[model samples]
Structures are given as structure tokens and as C-alpha cells.
Target: MSSPASSPSAPPDTGTRHITATILLACLGVFVSYLPVVGVSVALPVMQQALDASTEGLQWITDAFILPTAALLLTCGMVGDLYGRKKTYLAGLALFCLGCLVCLTAGSVVQVCVGQALTGIGTAALLPSTLALIGHVIPDPRKRARAIALWTAALGLGLSLGPVVNGVIVAHTSWRWIFLPSLVLAVLTAVLGAVVLTDSRAERERHLDIPGQLLAVVAITGLVYGVIEGGSSGWSSAQVVIAFVAAALGAAGFVVVELRSACPMLDMRLFKSSAFSGAALVMAVTLFAQVGLVFALSEYFGLVHHASTLDIGIRLIAINGFTVVLGPLVGRLMNRATPGLLLVTGLVIGGIGALLMNAFQAGTSTGEAALVIGVLGIGIALAMAPITTIAMDAVPHRLGGTAAAANSALRQIGSALGPAVFGVILTHRTLATLPGHLASSGLSPADQGQVSGLVSNVGIQAGAFLHLKTPASTGQAQAAYGASFTDALHTCALVGGIGMLVAAVIAVALIGIRPARSPQTAPEATAHPASAAS
Candidate 1:
């Protein structure tokens, strides 16, 4: 279907006011969408208790949102380009608001999962459209870079504030109230978007590759499901094996379909550019490490330190606060410094922070944790915007939506994998060490068996351990559980640090020193003419 143009009553000329309005709306849209990504982490323990959710169930609560986001992003980006960016963007906001309402009223974990899925779908639409609109509105390369950096800053702010805001809510009220801010922001963004943003789409008649889209979604869903379930269900279980096999087939089918399609959703040739591939990879790995670190640390603060929700948020400020200050600064410096250099430097710094976290023990001080987390915050701020700039710059201006979507989808994929992988590592390590601890505790076999059953699931293990009220053995149990939890945290940090180091290496190897050309100088598509076709 062809997209309609901007309102006929609107002015013919694109004014500075329109540009500013568009940027603001786009930034708010991005910020709102990202709030739930990490904010929900702070509320997971509360949500688990309220919903009586298992470890896997809690994982699904987060995965349900991330899975669809990762899967549908590329397809939705294409949809926005083919239909209309503004229209898609507004629709996304409305859907996001609806999702928030669902979550706000949710009575069960299943309902929350459904709500999160809807939000993810909305985000899949919102993210690419916002970036695409920015590309459409700002034609100048230098100016566009700055605008994108601002957009990235908005995203960083959302990520940084999610935990803090949600923590405060959980502290003062209930976890359900966490959705209120997102709902309010989504509505505001939608209203502003409809009034300010000009409708724009690719002026070409490209067919949507439905088969490729379906296959992509199926592949990502199956893969993420397998990873998430692998921790609870044995990795060798039939369900897990079947999921992996199906994912493999779906991915292979998607490749075949895309290669043969006349109009592909994602052009495989984009990966041919080392710069593009590297930037995308760096984006993925950065989130993988960052998200995993956050997940581990949030639990550490709550379970290990016995901190309240608000206190946990306050402690976490060391990790994400710098993004608020450094995001725009990095954007401003993009023209002066190579993005590759920034990406590498940031990754190295972040990796060091992750490595530092490996020293954490049951008795580690809060100040030490804050110092390490502060280093991580600086690294994330320096790297996040530059990688995005590099990725979008590498693609054709006309394909901005697709490029943005692909980059975002990959990052979401990494985000989904991070928690699952870390959770698995933590659960397995904890479980393995628990038996040794129990044996040494001199507990009777029956009591040991009961204890094992109680802590069988990683989701409730820490809380259960902390709240142990047995008069005879409470102290010994606490010490054993503390040691085991600390060991798991150390292992997770090591893995995260190694991942960041790998990303740094990739950034150094593939990212270039040069800046991309402006849209005016970018090549126009002659193969795919800008003509109206059914």
C-alpha cells in the first residue's frame, strides 16, 4: 500500500520549528521505549514474589519483550519505509501506551508477558521510524550526526533512569506503577509526532518480502526460547533440542529467501562492508556485556548487600549515570575523532570495569562496587553513540530505516542472550556449589534434600537463602549461600568482561577513521526507480 503525504493544511516549507519538534518527539519516543529494557530488572524480584513466578517464568517476562523486538525490527523498519515513517511512529506510540495499560493492570505473570510483547512490537516500529525520520528531515551529514547523537542520548537517559525510577516506585508504592511514566510519555510523544513530524517514506515501490520476515521472526524466537529454557530444562532435553533445530532451519530458510527475493527486507550486501559489520557487532556485544552486568549487579545489591529497592538504584547510579553527561559530548566529537577509536576506547574501559567486578566477594564494600561501576558508565557513554553513528553512516541514506532496524535488532538479540547466558552461568555455578556447602553444613540428609528443593530455582534461591529463619542453622546457611552467590557473580563478571574485550578487538580491526558522505553526495538508486507501483 502506498503511504499518504503530510497533512494538506500544513505548511509547504520545512521550517526549523518542524525540525526541532520532530527531534523532540523522536527523542521522547526513543526514551519511552527504552525505559522498560533495564527498569524492569530492578522490579524483577518484586514481580516474581507478586506473581509467584519461577526462574524461567521471570526470564520469559523480559524475553517476551526483547524477542519480538529483535525479530520484528528489520521487518517493521521496512514497513515504515514502505508505508510512512510518521504514521508508523505514531501507531507505535499508541501501541506502546496500550501495552503499558495492560502491564499496569496485569494480575499474573502471563498477562505481564503479553503486555511486554505488545510493548516490544511497538518499540520495533518506533525505533527505526524515528531514526529514519531524522535522516529524512536533516539532509546535512554533520547536522544529522549531531541529531542522531542527541537521539542516542535520549536512549541512554531512558536506560540510565529506568532502574532508578522503577526502584523508587517499588520502594514507595508497587511494581505495577512502573508502567505509568511510560504510558504518559508514550501518549505525549504520539500527540507531538502527529502534529510535528512530516510523513516520509522511500519514493520507490519495493515489495515486502513476507517470507523472509516470517522466517526471521521464527528463527529469533526459537533461538531465544532455546537459550532461555536451556537453563531450567536441561540443555539436552527434547524441547531444547527441537527448538535449536527449528531455529537453525528458520535462519537458513530466511537466508535463502532473502537471497532470492526481488525486494528483500534486509539487504545482505550491507554486511559486506567491514565497517558496517563491525559497528553492528560492537553494538550487540556492548549491550550483551552491559545488560548482563546490570542483571548480575542488581541481584548482588539486593541479595548480597540486603539493600532496599531505592538503595539498590542509588548504588547502580555509578554504572549508568555518566551516559547522561557523556552521550552528547561523544556525538559532538564524532566529526573530530574517529568513531572506531571511540568505540575501542570505550569497550576497553568498560571491559576493565567488568574485570574489576570479578574481585567482588561476600564482604566487598559498596564503595568498591561503585568505583568499578562508575568506570563502566564512562565506557558505555563513550561507545554507544559512536557505534550507532558508524552503523547508520555506512548504509545508504535511502535505506536508513533498514540499517537502523537491523542494527537495533542485532542489539536486542544480544540483549536477549546476555541475561539468559549469565543466568545460566549463575544458576549452574550456584547449584554446583550449594551441594558442597550443604554437605559441609552437617545437615541431615532429609533436611539437605528439603533445602535443595527450596533453592532448586535460581529465581528465588537468593531471597530464600537470605530469609532463612531456622534458629539452629540460620547463620551457617547464610554464610554458605553468600559464598556461592559471590562465586556466581564473579563468574558472570568474568564472562561479561571477556565479551567486552572481544568487542574492542573487533572495533579496532574493522571500524574506519573516515566519515561518511552527506545524503546529497550519497548515491541514488537507479536499479530501483522511485515510481508508484502496486
Candidate 2:
């Protein structure tokens, strides 16, 4: 896989002072993007209670960001390529800062959702441009790799630290403080970006694919909405079905349009290279498994173990901490080994770690849980950077922007879909087993249903399960609730284990053997090939 077309003219490498300033600015932008995701997740329970939000509303709060990020990523990349990348990036930060401020003052869930959307858009803008700018600014391949390594490290740090940071802020003060720090970071990054970043754009005029963009947005939004709604309304509901259908149709239209357009938003031709296709497939599956695993496990620790948001964040940090260390190493490994090897090894390790995590019981020791999660983190660390590097390497220079955008979009979608799909599984499993688990414990049928219902909604963390507020006949209800909660977690663990095993197979078979050759080979196919492959 080769890089996209070279920039019309590369920016000259500046002295250390300028490089340091520019790199710092770019890192800051990434840090700001990290704020909303980790910050909001920590605040989810608070947001739900404070706003009197329904399950649907809670889902929306999360979907609001994922939808926009997935929808707008390609468009933002195109915009950066067309206009000045530096300009587009700074503008994104400004919008993000404004959105954070809006979140601070949001009186309702709807308002917060809107603010989150804006933050998503800003994130979309920042993502591709950072890499594009790095490619532009650092002409040397080795130097560029190093720069990218630093950039990725910042991202790893931001994602990992985001929850911990929010945990401290939310615990000490209000959730509003989570948004407050972002305001300052956004402003600082924007200003730094303006002063330090070099202006870069495609010298040639590239017409915007308006219809393709619109259809892509519709498809992504519908998909995100459908996934979010499916959890509460049931996947069988007409509302959920319509949303999924709309998303599918819109996505189909997008494909049709891209195939026909002279300059498509997504060049479908990139799949020609077996290497590119392999890497992309790995990316999608890896993300699906990784994102889903994190969501399920985090909720399990918090709900079943009765951990606070801060405690949950700290526990999760063990996994992400490995990410921080492994991210740069993966980048360095790209210099010597095939990305395919790294991808296969990483996924297998991660899958194994996930399987081990399935052994966690409700009464499992904290040390055991932490060990399982830490192993999973090691896998994440090993795989993520190499996967990204492979995808970027797969495309040519001009398409780099699009390829990067698509990569980010798919990951976001995976992130969004993970929770919803797994949440459904968890809910169903809890409902099915809770009654039986509690029935023989001598609780009243009515009490069994109510306690089961609570566990279903919040998993095992519901305060009612902890004896904080028991029914009038409390003894039986308490024991029954505890047993039911344990049953729910057991079910989730088994299902999650199965998912990891499947992902491991795909990684091994689909990704196949690691390339002995250089990554610069032509992608198996072009973005818009004239001849169709059978």
C-alpha cells in the first residue's frame, strides 16, 4: 500500500522551534477532541438523572456525537483538501469550543445533544487534517512516521486520560466542569493552530460531491439513530426497522452515486489492493470487537461491582495505559514488519484477553478483573497504530484525505454500534434470566419482576440491589436481586467471549499472511477502476 498523491508542493521543514510549536498545536487539537467522548460517558448517569431522561434519551446523548462524526468526516476531509487544511482545522476547534460552552449552559437533554453534535463535527474536522498536515509539513518519511507516532500518542493519551480527568472533575464539582476545561483547551489550540500551522490545500480544483455527501449523511444518521433506538424500542419495532431500512437505502444510494461520479467522495476503487482490503477489513472487525468489549466491561465493572465513575475510569485506565505505551511501538514496528502481521498478532492477543475476561464473576476479586482488562489493553495497544498505518499506506496521495476520513468514520461507527448491539444483548439476557434466578429465592413474583427490571436497565449497579432501599419485605428481595444480577453478568460474559472468538477467526483468515514485501505496493484495486473485478 502506497501513500496518496504527493502534495503539489511540500512545506519546507522548519527549525525545531517551529516544529515544536506546530506539533504541540496539533496535539492540543486532538486533546480537545478527546474531551467530549470520555467526559460525557463519565457524566452519562448524572445526565440521565439530572435531566430525567428516558433510555432513548440516554442513547441519543451518545449517538448525537457518533452520528455527526461518521456523517461529516469525509466531507470535512474534502473541505480540508479543498480549502486550507490549517484554516479548516482551526475553524473546527472554534466550533468545538462554542459547543462545549453550550453544553455548560444546557438546560435539557435535547440542548446537550445539539452541543455534542457540534463537538462531533469539530472532531471530524480535526482528525484528517492533523495527519494530512503532518504529511505536508514533514517531507521525510521517517520523520513523518515519527511525527505521526507522536500525534497518535497524544490521541492515545487523550482517549485514555479523558475518563480519568472527567472522573476527578465530576467528582469534585459538577459535570459542567468537564465541559469547562474543554473551553480553555479549544481556545488555546485554535490560537496555537493559527500561529504555528502551515497552510496547505490541493492546488487543483476538486468539485464537491454534494449529492454523495448528502446521501452519506442520511445513511450514517439513520444508522446511528436506528442503533440507538433499537436498544429501547426493541429491534423489531417499526420505528427501529424504518430507521435501519432508511440507513441501508441511503448507503446504497451513496455507493451508486460514488460509482457514477467523476470525482467520488469515496473512491470505491481502493479495494483493488488485497493489502488495502485486508487492512480495512481488519480495521472494521477490530474496532467492532474492541469498542464493544470496552463498553460491556466498563458497564459491568460499574454496575455489577458498584463502582463509582471515578473508580470505573481508574480501572479502565489500566487498559488504556497500555495503549499509551503500545501506540508508539506499533508505529515503530511499521518500519520493519508487515502491518498484516501486527494486525493478526494484535487481534489474536486481544481476543484471547477478552476470552479471559469472560471468566470474571460478580464476586471476582478486583485484582483479577484488573488483570483481565490490562491484557485486553495490551492487545489494543499492539493493534490500533499498525492498523491505522496500514490503511493510510494503502491509498495514494490525493485519496489519503478520503482514506483517512473513511477510516475514522468507520471506527466511529464501530464505536457507536458496539454499545447499542451489546446493550441489547445484555438487556435481553438480564430479563430472561433474572426471573428464574430470583424465583427460587422466595421473593414475591411482583418484587422479582421489579428488581429484574432495574437490573435490566442499569445492569447490576442499581442502588436498589445494594440494600440501600429494599422493599417492605426486604430480606428475600435483596438476596433475589443479588442472584439475578450475578446471572445477568454471567450471560454477558459468555456472549462477549463468543464474539471475541469469531473476531479472532476473521482476523486470522481474512487478514491472512503478513506481507514479506514493502508497504508501497499498489493497493489491490484503484478507487474508480474502469474494469470491474469478477
Candidate 3:
């Protein structure tokens, strides 16, 4: 990405001070981008009441952000390369700050959804651009690995603290105020990046691929939409069926479009390298288990155990906090050992931790929950940094932005899929089994039917019964709910655990230890005859 004038034959390494300043802005950009993700879920109830939102309205509040981020990723990476990296970085920050402002002042749910879309766009633009910036500034592969690890840690920090921060905001002030801190940080980072950061892009020529962009949008949007709706409205619903069809067609169409286009947005050949493909798949499935389980566990603690938002956030800190704590150590390990070995080891440990979560119940002690979740967090921390390093290192350095975009898009898709997959499992399992639990509670048939109807009608929101204390009947209802929910939790854990183990096996087969070779080991040799996207 360096200009001929700026890049020397043996370019001296970037200054420590300069790299520090660059990472500060990059990390800040990443931090604020993720703050709203888990944070908003904590505030959904207040949002629902304030806006009088319907069930559909509540779902869109989260999807509004995810759809745009998933759809725009590759396009945003190309934009950074075609326009200027610094410009996209600044634009992304400005866009996020604007979205926060809009949401903070929103009076209706529609406005909030719109604002969320804007923020999602900003995230799409920011992710690859920031990672590409790291690639450009740091010439040494070893140094870049460390930088990317810190970047990953920043992302973890944002996610870990989001709920805690939002919980405090909701407890003390309005839920609307949750975006205030993010807005301030976005503006600050934008100013800092504008002042000190040097702009760069792909040294080789590239162009915007309109057809590819459009197809990517169609494919990703359809898939995410179908999954989200399929869970809520039932998989057999007409709209859900149409959405899946559109998604399949769009995905096929996208591959054809990219292959035929003169200027492809993403070079499909990158996946030919075992390293890149393996890392990308690992990222998707890992997040699938991680984020998906978070959604289920949050509901478990909130509804079944009657934990407040703050308490739930506190409990989750054991998982996310360990990720941040282990970041630096993981980076050093990757530098010293075979990254693929670490990757497989982490996934295996994570799989074990996920399987152990089946033991959790409404009465499970916080200490017991923490011990299991902490193991999973450690595995995530160990594996996350190495995946980025392996993927980034597998391709030519020039393709860093595009590679980051592709990997990130998969991660987002996994995240979006996580909630949908687990939510469906939890909802269907809970509803299907609730009646049986009620019937066994020694209640008369009429009373059993009445309580069962109330819980069944609410679907998974039967967690809404967490606080009901009306009478003996209510106590019976709560006990039945706890049993049903624990069953569902066990089911979710079994599915997630199996998926994690399967992904680990795939990682072992596809990725190998990096061999010692020439300094020009990757990029130059990795490129094919039609490597140029333009």
C-alpha cells in the first residue's frame, strides 16, 4: 500500500510512537462500533414500552444494525482502496456518531431502526479499513500480528463492557443516553485519525464492481432476513420460504457474477489457500457458538433466575473479561509457536466448556457458571487472534483490506445466525415441553391448561414470568418454567458443543503449521495470473 516515494527497498520499521498513535485511533474506532451491539439488548424492554413497539419492531431493532453491516463489508473495503483509506475511516466514524445522535434523539422505533442502519454502515466501513491501516503501517508480519491482537482485544473490551455500561445507564437514567459515550468517542477518534494517520490503499489498481456489490447485498440480506424471520414467524411461513429461496439464488448469482466480472469486488481465489479458508471458517463457527450462547444464557439468567440487567452483565464479565485479559499472551504465543496448533487446541477446549454448560440450572451457583464460561472465554481468547493472523498472513499483503472484509463478513453472519439458530431452539423447545411440566405439577387439569396457555402464548418470553409472585398458582407456574427452560438450555449447549468440535476437526484438516521460508513467502507466490481485480 505504500507509495513508491514513501516505501524504500529496506524500509525501516515504523516508529514505536507512530504505531502506538495509529493503534489508539484504530482501537477507538473498533470500540465504539461494537458498544451498541450487546448494550442495546439490555435496554430492549424499556425501548419496547417507550415506543410501544410490536414483537416485529423489537426484532428489527437488532437486525437493523446487522443486515447493513453484513451486506456492505466487501463494498466498503473496495471503497477504502479506490477512494482513500483515511477518507473511509473518517467517514465511518462520522457516520457512527451521526447514527448515535439520531438514536439518542429518536421518539419512535422507526427512527431508532434507521439510526441503527446508519451505525451498521459505519461499522462495515470501519472494520476492514482499520485492519488494512494496520497492515499498511506495519511492514513486518510479526509486528502486524501483535497489532491485530490488540485490535481484537479492543473489540472484546467493547462487547464485555457494553452490557454493564448500558445496565448502569438504564438503572440511573434513560436508555436513550447509552449512545452518548459512543458518540463522544467516535468524534474524538475521527479527529485523532485525521490529524496523525497517513492514508494508504492497494498499490495495484482496482475498481468498483457494481454487479458484485449488488449481488452481495442481495445474498447477505436475504440470508440474514430469512434466519431472523424464520425463527419468529415459523420456518414454514411463506415469507421465510421466499427469503431462503432468494438467499440461495442470490448466493449462486453472486459467485457467478464475481467470476465473470471484469473488476471483482472480492477475489474468490483467496479461498484456494488453506490458511485463509480455514481461518475464515473457524471465525464463523466460533462466533456462532460464542454469540449464540450469549443470547440463550442472557435469557436464562434474566428470566429463569430473575437476575437484573446489572447482575446478568456482571455474570457475563467472566466470559468476555478473560478474552481481554488473555489477548497479549495469545499474541506472543502465536509469534513463537505454530498458530494452527494453538487454533485447534483452543477450539477443543472451547468445545469441552460448551458441553459442560448442560449442567446449569435455575439454581446453579454463579461460581459454577463462571468456572465453565471462563474456560470457554479462555479458548476464545487463545483462538481469536491466531485466526486473524493466519488469514491475513495467507494472502498477499496488498489484499489485506479485502481479506479482512471477507473474514469479518463471515463473523457477522455467524453472529446473526447464532441468535436465530439458538432462539429457535430455545423457543420451540420451551413451548413444546412447558405443558408437560405444568401437567406434572399436581394442579387440576383446568388450572394446568390455564397456566400452560399463558406461558405458551408468550413463547420464549415466558421469562416475563420471572417476577410474578401472585399466589400458589404463580409459584407452580414459575417452577414449571424453570424446569422447561433448563431443558432448553441443555439442548442449546449440546448443539453448540457439537458444532464447536466439528469446526475444530475441520480446522485441523485444512490449516497446517507455517513453514520457515523466504521473506516473500506469501503474497507474491499466492497471487494467480488474474490476480488484479481491475
In order, candidate lDDTs are 0.80, 0.69, 0.79
Per-model TM against the reference: 0.93, 0.88, 0.93
330-372: candidate 2 lDDT, tens digit per residue: 7777667766677667677777777786577666778888898
How many residue pairs clash per model?
A: 0, 16, 1
Evaluate model 3: give its lDDT. 0.79
- Candidate 2 TM-score to native: 0.88
lDDT of each residue in 412-531, candidate 1, tens digit only: 988888887777887788777877877788766776666666787445444345434476666666666777778889899899888999999888788755554434554333122211
Q: What is the lDDT of residue 116 in candidate 3?
A: 93
Q: Is candidate 2 or candidate 3 better by lDDT?
A: 3
Give the Cα error of residue 276 in candidate 1, in Å: 0.8
User: Which residue ranges in model 3 land beyond 4 Å of their true spot?
Assistant: 1-13, 45-58, 107-109, 466-470, 513-534
**Model 3 lDDT per residue over 1-534, tens place:** 555423323232378887788787788888889888877765665676678664456567877887788788888998887777778999999899889999999999999999999999999999988898788777567778888889988988888898898888878888899899889889888988889877776766678988888888878778777877787788899999998998898889889988887667878877777778888998999988888788778778777777766777777765667668888988787777878888888888888888999989868998999899888888788788888888887777777888888888888877777766777787778878888888887666777776667656655564455333347767877788888888898898988888888888988888865552334455545554324432
